[model samples]
Target: MLPSVTFLAKFSPAHRRTITASAIHLTPWQPSSPQAEHASLSMMADKCKSMDQLKQIHAQMIVTSRIHDTFAASRLLNFCALSASGDLNYALKLLEHTPMPNLFMWNTVIIAQASSSSPFEGLLLYADMRRRGVVPGKHTFPFVLKACSNMKSVRCCEQVHAHVFKFGLDSDLHVVSGLVRGYSVSGGIGDARRVFDELGNRNLSIWTTMICGCAQNDSAEEAIRLFDGMIADGFEPNEVILCSVLSACAQSACLVLGEQIHEYIEEKGMELDVILGTALVNMLLRTDHWLKQNSAFMD
Candidate 1:
């Protein structure tokens, strides 16, 4: 296994997940290209434990004129932008200084910005990328849309959705999921459902996204309807979807369906963590109140 990510605390949990996943694909510096000193230095940036070591490597690359190699420059940019101890400002400066920043460099910085506290900056960066005539690939939209989701900007969500279709990335599941979330959070449930339905094939995650979107938007009937559809499609509901549907049931006072879901949870031996447990309790409370009212009125 690769070295433990010692600098994890410096980033948000989202960025930490991005870094951890990248570690598997990131190879150590290859020293075999003896004639290409820059290749060896680029590898060092991947293994850089701290900013000081990274700076030392950067200085060496500049002194050797290896900074001109876009690939070499990208390694330094990646470390600064995404690594825990490294600096985002420095990474931004490096990209600004580079004459031609590649797609990977754009993605690294965008991901960092998307998960950062100031996610709006991510949207600005994406706009700058487009202004520079850089066409975004599949990896780009998710982060861009994430920034939109964080800001809860309905206009921004619609704008991003336009780009998704313009680039023919509307079918990409990750990007689609981001759209569902962005639209949902911004109170654009109709748009969210439209996007969800347009997809020819949907995954469990997309289904969950649509259901949660409906539930959160006060479309309890739609949320419960979708949940039943999901089951018919052979998708097993996970904890998140269950919680969302339970919220829907609570809103609609769906006593029979709510009880059925509770039984299903028990049958599946699902753990009742805080979120799931709270959703369950809320559903029961609401339904029970309805029951008591109906019984009292009958008398």
Candidate 2:
């Protein structure tokens, strides 16, 4: 009986290691011979894939006193809250119990809130971060601005803009791009353009944002004009830019311009890709008269 018990104990550790390694990366606590309760807690954390799994893990941890370890508990909270399939509530609960959460901990929760479908929570988290005297960093602004965009809260966006200026991050290309996109999404194309114009050196993403803003506002002519300017500026049109240009053509039924773009795509060897080819076909079909005339000319 003693030999069998020892064998089972040894087997449990190896089995847990195998399971953890297969599902997620192993943590240091995983290899230690925890008490039966701690061992079970580790096992629960290993198998957590959804909110329900996290809840089971939490219950097991509570029963096993494994929650006493702050680091392990914090990790559990992060995993449960931030995992693709984990529950937000579970993560929050873990955070609440954390004695003195670090910046990383705060950032993780803030990001999780920002990325949730209801972005208002992200804004709230930002407010909480501020109240706690945590200085917002470059990483924080994008997520905060994204939440403002999602909520279409222009006032909040303006407030965030002020924060960006205060942080001297207003000139950051990525932050500037986010501000442009946020303004555009909030139906303030003028504001977006204003931000774009202030950019020191515009990248393709900034140009794309402006183009998309024009297209969404039924200003395809403006988008096309901008596309021409971008090309003249010697910025090679990438796949995203090409897609945006094609969208503008489809909207305006500018078959002549669309054909020119199609030709460019062919020359660039992008026409061989099924996705772009399909988009080109759809654009041509939308202007069938022009396509037929072009085919006749070729024949």
Candidate 3:
């Protein structure tokens, strides 16, 4: 499960200062009691809001006997690889010594590599996984597809899409979303739209993805049309969707539409925080001259 915003808010200025001081004073290797070990692992998992904390936990784990604990070790490896600075080398070293890693273990490492600076390393690991005869699961394709998206390797994405169908993950939301995103990023909007259309029930995230794809492809008209469709379908627009719509309006210099959106935002009592406010200001500035000229002509 994803961490709640409120839970993440706990890592505020005071907490970060305290954690940093504690990390500096902490002894890397110390003999730990069972209760202490359990507490340490729990804290490591919970307070992993920064790379500093992650490193501190990793160092503590190495110093203590809990380093060999499979569950703790796997979680540590995952946090390190995925969230903690994308340190693939360190993650690989830790995983190499883990005894009889399960599919989750492989999936975690592969995902880390896929999202890492060296994405080709992920492809290499996938090849190695096939050679080791570990059959890939549904969970495996999303990360690989993500890598293909990042690489913009259309051929590679197509191959993965085919494999997803073979593995019966064609109906899986996550796998299908990844395929759509991959094709979209690889300049295959038609393919992406086809994949999106096939989904039995379109979720908000899927709609947002399609909107973003259209926007990125310079199809602002299509993006605006889709946004209208989303509203008609009764999906309340979130900040992300609003931002995309604002961007499309700004690009098209549609001052009337932009003002209408601003009014909608105001009516909904949406917070005009920094980002949204900035976009609004930019759009108004860009179109203000036209508004002024029209008013003068009318006068």
Candidate 4:
């Protein structure tokens, strides 16, 4: 009988590791009906509410020799690596035990680890993937770059940026967006801008990324410039960004920048309504107040 969920939770890390290892290494066999069996087992794995339930399904797979199927192994791996109740250490163990892990499995583990408290683990997995000759698809770099973004590891980011070009994934919107964010976090606004400029098909997301990247790096002037360009490029400015750039402008306390926001709202006739009229009213009051302060200082 499997340990109760509460009992399993109470086990020491070492004991848990022992149990996970024993559960995964169940006597191996090649199932005669991997397709049907793995599919059904995968459904059971997906619906598992706790590790105990997952272990039961996993043991069933082993007994039926369905664990040899990559799809079946990956389902268990995905649940363990990603589910809220799942265990990452157990998932890593599963990755090793799988006879042949596929790109999806590798990516699933990488994605989970990249977003974990230890992002370097994700980077390590990426390096291991390269060592094993598992060619990364375009979807892979964004997650890899996400780790770099989390770590603020500019050098790692730059290395991954090189890999982006090497793999010809530089044009992937998500990849470049991640690159822009990674660069921005490390105060490499120029690198972010260069990446932003390199991409030809700039969606609102990419535009927002570059603009927010600028705004965050204290490059308010650049943010305002890009915001202008975003508007010129036929993209409507959303209120979140509108206020972000507006705050930067208000902080710079430059009347010209304040006027630019007003001009943008008035000129664009944007109907993506967001209580912007109140924002514009506040902008005018602040602009008036800013002018008063400067005028008094001149006196």
Q: Each prediction's Cα lDDT score?
A: 0.82, 0.72, 0.73, 0.77
TM-score of 4: 0.77
C-alpha lDDT of residue 19 in model 3? 52
lDDT (Cα, tens digit) per residue for candidate 2, span 1-299: 00122333444554644543444433424434566546556556756776655554554344345676665576676786688877787677677766666666676777788778878888887888788787888888888888888888777778889999998998888888888888888888778888888887988888988887787777788889989988888888887667767778988888888888877876765633555555566677777766644542343
C-alpha TM-score for every candidate? 0.81, 0.72, 0.71, 0.77
lDDT of 1 by residue, 1-299 (tens): 11123444466544543443345443334345535666667777888887767766665555456777889989988999998898998899888878889898898899899889998999989999999999999989988988888888989999989999999999999999999999999899999999999999999999999999999999999999999999999999999999999899999988789878887987887887878877887887876656633432342
What are the per-residue Cα lDDT tens digits for candidate 3 across 188-282?
A: 88888889888888889888988888778777778898898888989998887787777888888777887888778777878766677666666
Deviation from truth (RMSD, Å), model 4 = 8.5
When sorted by TM-score, best at the front, the candidate numbers are 1, 4, 2, 3
Give the per-residue Cα lDDT of candidate 3 at 104. 76
- Any idea what lDDT model 4 has? 0.77
Question: What's the C-alpha lDDT at position 126 in model 1?
Answer: 93
What TM-score, to 2 decimals, does candidate 1 have?
0.81
Name the better of 3 and 4 by lDDT: 4
Runs of candidate 2 with Cα error greater than 4 angstroms are 1-74, 271-279, 289-299
Cα-based lDDT at residue 86, candidate 4: 94
Instruction: List residue ranges in candidate 3 displaced over 4 A.
Output: 1-72, 83-87, 253-255, 289-299
Q: Candidate 1: where are CA atoms >4 Å away?
A: 1-36, 287-299
Pairs of colliding residues, candidate 3: none
